[model samples]
Target: MGSCKDEDRNEINCLFVHGPIIIGAGPSGLAVAACLQENGVPSLILERSDCIASLWQQKTYDRLKLHLPKQFCQLPFLNFPKNFPKYPTKHQFVSYMESYAKHFSIEPKFKQSVLGAEFDNLTGFWMVKTQDFQYFSRWLIVATGENAEPVIPEIHGIEKFQGPVMHTSVYKSGSEFQKQRVLVVGCGNSGMEVSLDLCRYNASPHMVVRNSVHILPREMFGVSTFSVAMALLKWLPLGLVDKFLLMVANFTLGNTDRLGLRRPKTGPIELKNATGKSPVLDVGALSQIKAGKIKVVEGVKEITKNGAKFMDGQEREFDSIILATGYKSNVPSWLKGENGLYAVGFTRRGLLGTSSDAVKIARDVADQWSMINKIFPDIDTKLLK
Candidate 1:
């Protein structure tokens, strides 16, 4: 990569990357970098945080585990350790990600948050500006993925609530909330898991189920639910697969509506494909709900001083509020893809999608690299110097 000084004497370094400049050092970015390296292409990864997979390293709760089997969650070039369980813990997954990076000799520049990125029409390159440096590259890979930022829903009168209100991103454990009545907003996987964790800590948690959801048993008949679905999908149509899944789920987990968790009219897979909303895979929360340890509540109408008033006109008191509201992609806030800019990990299909996208991106970039090299021999040696 070439470097130059600006005329303003500001000492702001400008770098011209020979290969793609990847943003975010999450699993997606790491996977792309590894694939590119295997394809005999170099890549520069920029991480906003100090460590790789900042979402897993810093934001996630302690008890979080891979919702899918380890095989499905593994990156493009490396596999999870043989000793690891089918569902690896959060720490174990992070460790595996670290090993994957090391195996590929991928060293990312940490704390280089991209302020903005745009395709420079005149230069035919991507101009990515960070807090400290300006990067110009032929290829730009946005691996920041979805869930780059936590989504805190706007609750009416939330400011009026006297209790400590926080998002699940900052939540670590329920041990600190022992014996406290906690109100968890949202009915997604995180919300369910958090409520389960709270119950384990002897904390009374009331989870808000605002909308219809699909909760499936993590496994069925000794096989993963996802695996079963995939196996069925190969032979049956999508609607048939959904019907089969719902049938099995009903038989396995019983009718969740009786417990206040209503099923959506749209099939889980269909809904997911359409909206990127994942069906909740039960890890132990349903049992807690059935046992009456975790109470289910309706949507909040307004946050009161001690708790919240529900949409059903019921009010409840709680010591704290945990917003398991989920996360969203911050891509549109900073990136304007036009020319050679590519985005991976936003497919909402999770790690499987990430791995698939990473390989495609690497191959595409490699093909262009080869074509450019053939057209301009010694281009890297002379121009990149």
Candidate 2:
């Protein structure tokens, strides 16, 4: 519990005699912690926020549901309550995670944000430092996730606009945008869902079409598409699968104007070959598009005092704007490492067994953690079960 002095901090590499430190309290972190505890591996978790799954509580818009089914989404030893709905709501997810924490009795030291982590060449342990606390551990699990920071696109005069600007990460409900002409930027699930939520509140929500995205219904033929996609991806090549997905996306929600905005590009948004490997399925958004509840615009060229200027050279006015853009994974500074540091759940989906993220990372962690416990029998990995 002692703060590391600037000089003593220099000896952090030698001070890391602890077993391991898990960062974040989300599904991945909790899962790893449970597994480690089951095995009796001494570990500690450092979380910046007071509650578990803080990101979940902070980022989602109204009526947001998990894209995956409850059955597939539950973590480690825990199962979603039998009474829970098929696609668990955000609140349901938070509750489930809370239960997981209680069941495991994993107490994450709150308000202790990991600022950076570094691996010492002389010692095998990782020196993790935070704003208030510092610890040393042999292993590091960077489970902070990919969507940790809200992504706001830069536009000319975006800050100069008089209207309020907010990102989807902090969007809880649409009641604030009621009766206001709002622009929902980005065409992903967040963008579409936020736009629809605003519409239900009697707000005129305009969608800014950035690119064409694939949207799938939560249930198809009485089964979740998430299950179906998981099954298919297991056997098919990723490239072929991506191509097939593009076709299906085009068929269900045409290439351009799916959200009233035009997309000249027939393919999915251009993500770096490293970044755009895995494809995320979109649901409800597609139905809303066909319902004519949302209006789409090409792109934003600049922001004006009156409103936004589009790439098509048209200016429109809005009382407020919501950026349903995306988020970036923010690793705590304490865990900064040179090598032998592991980052799970931030992978760009590509060829099978290629990288770690999502369900794949969960499975890998389960396997690797088990293997390590077996090799280091004294580490007390039985808590994982």
Provide the overall lDDT of each model, using Cα atoms, as 2-decimal numbers: 0.92, 0.67
lDDT of 1 by residue, 350-385 (tens): 999999999999999999998998898666455435
* Model 2 lDDT per residue over 61-155, tens place: 65888766777677766788999988799899899889989998988888877776877676455777777556766677776777667877897
lDDT of 1: 0.92
In terms of lDDT, the best-performing candidate is 1
How high is each candidate's TM-score? Answer: 0.97, 0.81
Instruction: Give the Å shift of residue 369 in candidate 1.
Output: 0.3
Stretches of candidate 2 off by over 4 Å are 1-4, 8-17, 234-274, 277-283, 332-335, 348-385
lDDT of 1 at 213: 97
